[model samples]
Target: MSMRKPLAIFISALMASSAANAAEVYNKDSNKLDFYGKVVGLNYISNNKAEHGDKSYARFGFKGVTKISDQLSGYGQWEYNVKTNNPEAMDMGNATRLAFVGLKFADFGSFDYGRNNGVLYDVSSFTDVNPEFGGDSFTKEDNFMTGRAKGLATFRTSNFFGSIDGLSLALQYQGKNPNPHKSEDRRDGNGEGWGASTSYDLGYGIQLAGAYASSNRTDIQASDKNGQTADAWNLGMKYDNAQLYLAAMYAETRNMSHYGISNNRYAKKTQNIEIAAHYLFVDGPAEGLQPSLAYVQSVGKKLDPVSKSGDAADAAASFKGGKQDLVKYIEVGTSYFFNKNMYTYVDYKINLLKKDTYTSATGVNTDNILGLGLVYQF
Candidate 1:
């Protein structure tokens, strides 16, 4: 009875039959077309870069809607992500996670344009609940709360002053980027962003989230052109009772800059945290499985310079030399599940280098990471 125990008991009873009922539609008269996809693969290891690897991928999408009359409705999605790592270059060139189009105002909510995801990434994607991997916060720093800002544009709302039960709201923008992001090592540019996010579901399981964003040609330096600015904010909490689940998140990033003379400085200040809990074992032998744990603590500094000083001892003599910072760590293992589109997992991460405070005991442990993966969302 090996072979993953009959494919984990045939994916815990016929995959709980779903895939959104296998979308693929094409209604005639009223006009409708649908299709969707998802796939992720992994097999990796790292004891601070010892290296071991495996990869996989597949992602597809397409959607449609039409009913411009009975109160408006029109939607779309064209997603992309395909690269079998490298089986003789099975690469699919550029990756487009989501292409959008929308207009749905049945109860007053929806407005979209090309290149999706903003709204501070829909409130930090709800702590990014790890399914088979470590939680993600806009890939760590780069996202900085702009949350997938790819020439985006958006607006969403529902349950604002109407009832306020499980309220919702989102707003975003990222105009101007027609090939204006450059890079040498890393200091690309092109941004004129705006963002907002909110969520509430004070139900028995509790929920609350928040977000904030700002941008101005986000550049990581290399002489920040268009003069930097990338603000961010976040908050989170969650508690689910489908057996057990918990969440936490915190974010803060500010990258204000102005070249020389320490003008409006900030140069980058950061803080990020993540936490999670899981427990699901519905039946026997880990029926449908689920054993998860996650934690992330990121702290970065060295640009406060007296909080953008305005003469606080002249910013303490510009730090009188001596400052270095970096920190990130986490341990997450189980993320088991064979339902909700299948699952599997493992992960570990650590990196410590904090020189003038924030103890790491003389620092030594480096970029450690180990990962195991699988995800099958169709």
Candidate 2:
């Protein structure tokens, strides 16, 4: 859950260019400054039906804003991701996913500290925006509610339940700073956590969201029976207008902590269900062209062993105990748009792991994915 996402992108494009009529880089009079950024990349191919692979990566970000008046404002951002399949030594600690600096309150609402994004995964952010991976996969996932955490601090709100106008909300916290170069009991995501989310816009396009989160694993020393605490929750629904887009979600997590569970550190309990839809036929010949489909499912059981490695091979993998681990996923994609900066895409995913009877590799991340990408937004 430390994948680092959504830094609320430079305070939502610096509040749409300082609340309108703003394209300044230095507009003297009433004070103004703005700057935005974008750059993304995705390249993929993998068969895993024995073996076949390809990889790619590219990322960059930018943002700047300053408007201290008419309600106050300030912003900053910095992003990175250029590993191109690991160019030998490119760890850069984390390639600085986001630098962070923020404050905005046109009427009250906005704050960011360091690393962000973790309001319980923003209610599944509409199926994780399916541009590539869907919410970072699951099953014992360490996706900690869609990743990103590091002395985090967040808060956001809008219409928070007043003028009825599309209510919104967010809250987050992450702390346990103590990385004197790792190993201080090493439990970055465990020591502290907090989350919250809310959304509403039940009008035409429909939208409703919910989220909740918790964390505390202090390296799991609470007389372990599966770490001390870890929690999650979600509920979502989305519907978009122009061209169509639909989303559905119901998520759950408990104890989680994955990236090789049973490989030990033990944490489990999961359940995920998703539904997705996409469309874009903007009129004529499949206008901008868009097509997408999705269906995801995850289920889990088996977990009971804070001691016992008798026949290790993840000893009866998939959790063990009473056994149960269902997984099914499907994703299809397409996107085309040769204008507006740029656009191009292709995806095909398939993940199935409904097998049991002890197979290990610690629950192989079932696969069958293919992808192509090109996106540009200014």
Candidate 1 to truth, TM: 0.32
**Number of backbone collisions per candidate, in order?**
0, 5
Tens-digit per-residue lDDT, 1-378, candidate 1: 223444444433332222342465798766788876767798666653435566566777777888888878898777777766666645554377677888888877888888766666565555555554455533332242344446677878778745675898888777745323334323334457677888888898777878887876534442434246677787887777555667787877666222122222334656777787766666667666666677765554554333224443553323432233434556656666666566777765544433332222222245566777787875
Candidate 1 minimal-lDDT segment of 10 residues: 256-265
Could you say which candidate leads in TM-score? 1
Across 1-378, the per-residue lDDT of candidate 2 in tens digits comes to 111122123222322232222234565654455443334466667755432443555555555667778887888666665656555666542366566788888856888888655676676657765556565444222234456555778888788734557889888877754423244322334557778888888888788888888777655323345657777787888877645677888887776534243334333677778887766654456566667788877665554432134443344343444334545678888877554445678978876664444334344555677888776654
Clash pairs, candidate 1, are none
Cα RMSD (Å) per model?
A: 19.1, 19.4
Off by over 4 Å in 2: 1-122, 128-133, 136-158, 170-195, 198-212, 215-227, 231-241, 244-255, 258-279, 287-289, 293-347, 350-360, 369-378
Taking all chains together, each candidate's TM-score versus the true structure is 0.32, 0.30
Worst 10 residues of 2 by lDDT: 1-10
